[model samples]
Target: MLDEGFTYGGLLMGLAALVLWIRLALRAFPSVETMIARYQDEFVVPEARSHGELGRIAACATAMALTFSAIGYAIPD
Candidate 1:
C-alpha cells in the first residue's frame, strides 16, 4: 500500500515537472522570427543564451523527476 502511494506521488511529481519543461520550452522558442531576431543581433545573443540556459535547467528538472519516480517505484511496501 505504501509503495503504491509512493508510485502515485512520483508519477504526479514527474507529470508536473514534464509540464514545467514544456512550458519553459514553449516560452523560450515560441516562433522562428523571434529566434532569428535574437541571433541576428551580434555574435553575443543574450536572450538566446538565457533561453538555452533555461532549457538546460528544464532538462535537469525532467531528469530529476524521472529519477525520483523510478526510485519511488522501486521502493518496497
Candidate 2:
C-alpha cells in the first residue's frame, strides 16, 4: 500500500508539472485562444465564462500537488 501511494504521488507530481508547464506555455503564446476555440468543437463547454478549462485544470493540478505533499508528510519512514 505504501509503495502504491508513493508511485501515485510521483505520478501526480508529474501531472502537476505538466499542467504548470502548459500554463506557462499558454502565457507565452497568446494565440492559445485560437487553439482552444478550435478544440471546442470536439465537446461542450459548461462554464464558458468561469476562467475557461485551462485555469480549472491548473487549479486542480495545484490541489493534487498539495494533497500529495500532505500524504508524503503523513507517510512513515
What are the root-mean-square deviations of the candidates from the true structure over C-alphas?
A: 4.9, 8.5
74: Cα error in model 1, Å: 0.9
> Best by TM-score, which number?
1
User: For candidate 1, lDDT tens digit of each residue in 1-77?
Assistant: 76666667777767877887788767765467656776787343344435576677767767777776687778875
What is the model-wide C-alpha lDDT for candidate 1? 0.69
Scored against the true structure, residue 15 in model 1 reaches a CA lDDT of: 84
TM-score for all models, in order of appearance: 0.51, 0.45
Off by over 4 Å in 2: 1-4, 7-18, 21-25, 28-51
Deviation of model 2 at 24, angstroms: 4.8
Error of 1 at 38 (Å): 15
Instruction: Output the TM-score of candidate 1.
Output: 0.51
Report lDDT (CA) for all predictions.
0.69, 0.65
Q: How does candidate 2 score on lDDT?
A: 0.65
